[model samples]
Target: MLYNLYNEKKDNRKEKFWFRAIFYLFLLIFIGTVCWIFFFSSLLKINSVEVIFQETQTEYDLFNKDYLISLVKTAFQTESSGFYLDHISRANFFLFNVDHFSQLIEKKSLWISKVEIYKKFPQSIQIIIIPRDGAFILQGEEDFLVDGQGMVFAKKNDFLKESATLPILSFEMKRSVKINDQVLESKSAKFLTIISSIFSEQSGFELKPEFFTPSLISNELEAQVVIDNGWKIFFNTERDPVIQSKLVRKVLDEVIKEKISDLEYIDLRLPGKVIYKLKGQPINADDSDAQESKSESKEKKDDRN
Candidate 1:
């Protein structure tokens, strides 16, 4: 009986030994897999990067390969160094957070409007870029490039200097504005920006005003625009610009069709009305002589009668 008990105990020891061995092997594999997934994995490394610009733009050099690679590397390094003790907080093919990368790109540039990152599993990354739409040039103490949102992105460059097609705005400010600052925050500037968008849509009737002037008249805001012709058209700041523009266009078109070149001023301050002035003709001495002759003839006819 004791021999049988010893044999049973030996069998139990063998079973325990095998169980421990298998458990230890699985533990080692788990640790190794975690390490491989977090680091030193060929499937998770960034092998190739592709840049795709959404539209044709020559303004900024944000799509250079070297520049984008460096930007990505910097973003990943920051993610890896964060204090969160968790599983694989990094930027890689499989583990890269697209939203985080987008946010990083946005923070890096003030002119970039949209950024999209696409990952082709285990190797390549595609980045799509969309820049802000440029509206017009604002000429003040210093010239600036303004966007549709009235945001001043950069200083005026010579590339678009021949943009006579775009309207020029002249504003006077007592304070200075920094780069990427929004200087066109006033109501008049906003109205002008909205009008520019409208002009862009209307291809049939192009309203490319040469200049915009905003001022205060009788403690009320007023805006004036010089159209293609030399005439100065006035607008009331309190009125809706859309309605005012429509009225001005209708009156101007009529005047233009009539071939009237004596236009001096156009006032669109009144609701649903347009007030205009024309250059008056001066009377000459010839007109007086003709009138005197006609009067003498009429007097002689009356005496005969």
Candidate 2:
């Protein structure tokens, strides 16, 4: 009876040992397979890159596709911590840093407001480029597209067909302003948008952009809405456009009675009055927005001198 009990115990020990050994071998094989797939195999490495411009149509065909693709390739090879890549030709799909790649590409152009990246799995990467939209077009001899952030990102030729409908901010350019320039500050850009919509709503006609000059006004702090050759309206770009627009409505309804034929210009920058000039008249005075006007006039004079 003792010998039979010993044999039974021995058989159970052998079964447990074999089970553990087989389990370990399978576990090792699984681990090795995973390592090969993730780290060593070309299957998970980046091989193909595709870039899409969010707004650009496929028919347009990218103007600088090769350059853009080069930019993307450079961005992909780059390391997360540094601007340049280490000697690696391609990154593993799981290891590509999307955030870092986006930042690197966005810095390459002011026109690029955002960049989105997606791993198309196994061996491909997809990139989407979102170009900035214009809040207003700064109409110089060369029209420049201005964004809500007051940045000039692209020229008229570079912008799409919708440029015609956008409100204009015509500048009598004494000096050339180029791409990536902050032609208007953030507040002024917001200010222009408000007043442009107001003018469009009130006039019942599409008006040209408010005119600006380096010497006089409309660079940033002030804007002039020109009617004809010498006809215009002056605005304090700093004030609330809603209140100013309402005051303009009041002046038209009560004072001028909407008779603009003889009107030369209306100045809405004054403290208490809406000052205007007619064809043959002297300047309808305020305090003539004295402090504000005089200071701006002085700056213009200073620029002139």
TM-score of every candidate relative to the true structure: 0.62, 0.65
What would the per-residue lDDT of candidate 1 be over residues 100-208, giving only the tens digit for each residue?
7788777776556788888887767787866555566777777666676668775665233343344566643345655677655446555664664453343124444
lDDT value, candidate 2, whole model: 0.66
- Best-fitting candidate, scored by TM-score: 2
What are the per-residue Cα lDDT tens digits for candidate 2 across 1-305? 99999999999999999999999999999999997788667788787888886743333332344454566667565543221245333477787778877887788666678999998877888888776665667876687878877888877566346424555676554558798887777877777766766765765333455556343135333444444553566767756565556665656666666566777777776555568887787866544244544555676689799
Instruction: Report every candidate's CA lDDT.
Output: 0.57, 0.66
- Lowest lDDT 10-mer window, candidate 1? 282-291
**Model 1, CA-based lDDT:** 0.57
Candidate 2 residue 88 C-alpha distance from true site, Å:
7.4
